[model samples]
Target chain A: MSHDLDWIAADWGSTRLRLWAMAADGTRLAERSSQPERAPRTPAEFETILRALAGDWLERTGTIVACGMLGAREGWVEVPYRPVPCAVTPAALTRAPVAAADTRPTLSLHVVSGLSQATPPDVMRGEETQIAGFLAKNDGWDGVICLPGTHTKWAHVSAGEVVSFQTFMTGELFALLSEQSVLRHGVAEAGWDADAFADALSDTISRPEKLAGKLFALRGGHLLDDLDPATARARLSGLLIGAELAAAKPYWLGQNMALIGSDTVAHPYAEGLAAQGVTVLRADADDMTLAGLRAAHAQLAGA
Target chain B: MSHDLDWIAADWGSTRLRLWAMAADGTRLAERSSQPERAPRTPAEFETILRALAGDWLERTGTIVACGMLGAREGWVEVPYRPVPCAVTPAALTRAPVAAADTRPTLSLHVVSGLSQATPPDVMRGEETQIAGFLAKNDGWDGVICLPGTHTKWAHVSAGEVVSFQTFMTGELFALLSEQSVLRHGVAEAGWDADAFADALSDTISRPEKLAGKLFALRGGHLLDDLDPATARARLSGLLIGAELAAAKPYWLGQNMALIGSDTVAHPYAEGLAAQGVTVLRADADDMTLAGLRAAHAQLAGA
Candidate 1:
């Protein structure tokens, strides 16, 4: 009997690691996740864990191609990054040789390279695949695409490759501001104030420099007098979004741009932008990441 | 030897209740503070707490003049608030009869009426007296005076009355933004970034509307890229201060203003405003509040 299994795909990042057992035709047979094996996990430990989780499948399968953190410098094995200006192809996800015990079954391992920014020196681990996935699915669309998360990505994608991008800590800031800041006391219930947000966006576009001081006004508006806490919180949202709009302006200008992410992340921008009469394209986050992972695995199976 | 203690000065507000035993000469002899007995405490309970703290002193001294929350409607004796266009004189304070109590202990408790803003529904607690003290000490100056605290106040003082003022929750915002927000991660350490703060302030002033979105950029700047947390924190500060400056533009009018408070609160604004060439007058907060309290008490004592 022939096993329909082929290459495996793993999306290992700093915090999450997901692996899929794919067939030669990109059919996912089984999937599993474990703590990312960065520096602490020994080869034996990884082998044991992988075997226990997908050992039966690995035994039946021949090669595994893992993208994301697994291919990082600090991954289980040192697979040199394909570096920027490289395509998200099988050639770029080239494998690094691993020394395993004689009892170990033969499996090919490949890692993907992360991207970095110059100047202030910013980088991302697993998001590149998501971007690639987004591009792969949308084929030949050029403009700015925002992937909002803890470390948000504002990418300029054209010609099927991410040309350049910037990361903003929007999600992290929201978490901190809502949960930790005194502004929490004044935040209103979750609801969008298109007018407030638009006002803030216009503020950013007009007075890019005012980004800093405007933050305190959130508290000032609510505290100096009786202010609706929900409005205050919304104002905070407006402020952060406004700042992102300002920082992302350089890349956002004169280009067709679409915001891709969850509703939680994209809706606010959509609301704010819609008020400004800017058309924004919405894309599903999970689908793009999964699709990208699937595409990477397909290329490896073909190789 | 008999002590001719002339007046009583009190600093009453939401959380704290402070009463000072001052001589006719305005020499403070002893001071007492407790949780403000606003509404929760009955007249008996309120008077008991007050008498227990200062009953003996009042007996030893002649008539005692008092100020602060003790004269509010919620006080042990309700003091009717003299509406706007009324002076902060001893007559205005004494015009309203104290609520009927047991034996009047020859102590005259005068309450200062809170100031209300017509344009925006807002009011000030005992800070008006503090503003009065600042004005009295400066010998009738016409300019802006900022009292920074839980609810920071920027008062336009001229002709002995607070002409018009706006309060900004600068202190509250600082507390909330620093502790509750994801910005907390980057702002764990407290250090001032003059440039970052100035930039934020400029950002706010330039784009007053961006007030809502500026804060999210903190996390974006810090997490997505390598931004100095210190600078990020300063940026937050700058955003708030900048917003305040924008709000205070009407009051400032490019005129020289005095900052009435300690360096702890005024220093940041002073530094931020210096760049804009706004001249600041620094005065002692304690001395000014005490002076105003004394003045109010003296008026009530004679009445």
Candidate 2:
């Protein structure tokens, strides 16, 4: 198909690189992804990887707005994190210095700096872009935004800026314990038991300290009582999410909260919250990423 | 040195086999260990492995008292778990059936049954033998005994029997997070910060739900503010143990607790509990294992 690409919106993470071709009006023209052998060790490598992934879509003097681990210190260029209590807008994005070698002369790359907090010391990379996208659509969201994933984040945004945030290794812990730990013996690869999930959620939220013991019980329950694998998997997830909710009570309690992530990941957060009588709105993670990148591109154009 | 071996006391776990030669009066004659290529798959395999490890020590007729995973369903013999609230004595031990093959008619083997609680549905193999050893040393002592290891256990003992207990995967979680998870980047393999550990213990105990976030903070703290790896490791250990202490409050609070394990592992638990104003007595785990096995031998003789 003949196309006139205006700019590129990219989310470059540690393991994968995703790029979206956009028109001048911020409409997506095309999308592509490539698994980099490893994280680019230098800016030159990043350019090579980026060009290889989106060489066809790059137009002369086109802008490329990227977010995620690409902005990390070990990424293409070390972009300093913007302290929290500040809005994540296109104006806040940092430009990466192109390599001296002539490669993609037409591509001007810009990476959105992640957000950081001094007290308690926490940080987020790509999620900031998702937050920016959610805020761009909502305009006046003054509550909590939960981004659940490998490292789930519970962020408190107010007056268009992230006031405070916390991250839980809940997702990673779940993956490791279920797939690698002794619990692996009892939990199935894929299954769902809503009742078990809910019960475990309630049980954990009410007494999160029981998490370690409860985790072992998933294995024991199966061995002793024939607790099905599906129920075991669901309960494991529920226990983790429940513990997270209990810890993040200060973030979601009595506050309007929205979940911004993939449907598969965010659904459990929604369910867990709803079980506690808390209603939450949901937003697609990819849509938000695109919107946030587009917003950054627009800021670059206006500049 | 030539030795007169009366009996053998062993703690055969999944990965390692530990054997202790005992005189008729319960004096340890010798000790040895070997890593089984894999977990013994059947009764015959267990017999083969056992004979290989201690064949030279066998007299004309000898009793082998064993504990730990040897009694597990997958171990030498599938011995039924003795429900808690009962004394762990030699009489409580189960004898594994001798295979008809006449390899070593001089050896009669017995494996101690582990303790199981139905309410929380927790099980322990080796720790029960240690508990039995501790109780044998201090009969009529009624309080809590904490055994720290791969799975830390807190048992409530009364009137020479285990009333109830809970198990925490604190050690395993620490190992997994520090060596396998993202936190591994921030934590050092060795070194410690006493102050950092104490602070984290207090923080997690007060707000355990914050565990997931606090754990992530270790990595963030290092990235943002150059948190030293030693302190990070100590803080991680403290956070896990603190969360455990919070959940095990019902067991440790207002109870005379003793820590039974190696000095290296039990010291932290001792320090943590001491920080909470609870002084705990320490018992060497190996010594306890030998004593418990000796007590079991005495019971076998009486029986």
Candidate 3:
């Protein structure tokens, strides 16, 4: 759309598509987004959805580097997972299948491959890019990189390669327990109870086995003692996150850790880690996603 | 109704109603059941449901003794919970409101009071009856009763009373994780993999906190390793139940444990306990429910 527009950086997830119009100098010129009423059902529909989001920005014959679920099996194209004990960004990018209506054939589309771990069996889609971006910024940073969201990830990074990583369903568990489980009767949708969170976190972390047994108390506390919904909500969050921290202890203990997320989802992880005497370096999640995409796009532009 | 039908035994839960027509000699003369298209909404609707299920059995001026969600606040009437450190059955039962129907004023409805604990704040609706029934059969039994279901209960039964208990979302978590979570993509509905269940159970029981981390492996293993769906299903069940067993170690360790339920649901719990070297005494859940209701009815009749 502009004379300075060089390429596009995209982060395509299951529910939304985000595009960043980038200048030749790597500065973000403009940005656009679209949350379709329904998820794109066909591979061709993904292209249609992307075009609608970044039509004007697609005027030039430039490359688009994307990450996230767009590389998933059901996405526009299936990108082979670059197994861990390897570089964050793959040596090659998977090209999206071009549709017949392509006005600019040279306007190529490339997706970054997700990372997978073999021994314990784990995989991540959009997160691999963020890890790459964080590593790009802090070159030679050898420690754990945590990307917290629906499926929170912890990676052991060293020698500029992800040695190994693990994924935890902490955030998803909090959602299901607070909204879908019997705890739904006691937990409020959006509420804060800081003390309750801290206590529950400490309680579960020290005695992690009690996690499953303690869940029903949320509903019982409400029914029998009229426990506050807000407190119950915070406790539910603490219980799940605390369990994750207990399991991820090996990843963060005595290791420099960088948490890539904003206050919304990352604060708790930061606090949880801090409680264990580990100071967490933090980065904004959006910046990291774009940075990762920019890093991948730079490779394509260089090639 | 048969002339021998003296009193009725009912276990009215959320989705279904079960009625046992009983003779004066404590024999179950006949039985009937109904799974309503919809859960009963009004108090009158519950009575209407019972009538439809046992209309002929309502011929005489006798009593209807019941337990379960029919005693929940949203059920027929709110039965005040008898706090723990007390008898399984209170001296008096709460009577359901008599509707305007004039057929049998003497045919009263007596609902059992659920039990509650204050320290951890736990409550039980229907499981208390099963515990009571098990206690009646093995008088002076001083161990634990494991009732595995949607919300599995592990109760400490001593001195003919429930001293303490804990409720785990293990069964419910298995249903949600295997049927609703991302693991749903890889798990089978009705398949069996015994070894997978055993190994997962052993792994998690030793390190219960790893649960949140290991769930994604179910999906990843399927995608990357062609892990069988049946094994995935069994692994999911084992993981949740293992975590519960670890949390409930104090309840079953070095204690006589009786598992109440048919093989469909109770087998895993029994096996898990057996793995821990605890020989589990087994009982049919339905029989236990009737025995508890009969114990209560015996009190009413003698009174």
The DockQ leader among the candidates is 3
Please give the distance, in angstroms, between residue B249's alpha carbon in candidate 1 and its true position after superposition: 3.8
**How do these models rank on TM-score, best leading?**
3, 2, 1
Best by TM-score: 3
True contacts kept of each: 0.13, 0.70, 0.78
Chain B TM-score of candidate number 1: 0.80
lDDT of 1: 0.65
Lowest summed lDDT across 10 adjacent residues in model 1 chain A is found at: A82-91
Which portions of model 3 show Cα errors greater than 4 Å?
A1-3, A59-62, A89-91, A101-107, B1-3, B59-62, B89-92, B101-107
TM-score for chain B considered on its own, for each of the candidates: 0.80, 0.94, 0.95
Candidate 3 residue-wise lDDT at B226: 86
Candidate 3 residue-wise lDDT at A288: 88
Interface RMSD after interface superposition, each candidate:
6.3, 1.1, 0.8
Off by over 4 Å in 1: A1-114, A120-126, A149-152, A160-163, A167-186, A191-247, A295-303, B1-21, B30-126, B149-151, B169-173, B176-243
Model 3: lDDT of residue B29:
78
Residue A70 in candidate 1, Cα distance off native in Å: 10
When sorted by lDDT, best at the front, the candidate numbers are 2, 3, 1
Please write out the lDDT profile of model 3 over residues A222-263, one tens digit for every residue: 998899999998898888888899988899889998999978
Residue-level lDDT of model 3, residues B8-43, one tens digit each, is 999987677899988877888788988999888888
**What is candidate 2's lDDT per residue for A57-140, written digit by digit as tens?**
764435789999988877888899998888876537887887565554656789888999998899999999999998889988
- Angstrom error of the Cα, residue A163, model 2: value is 1.9
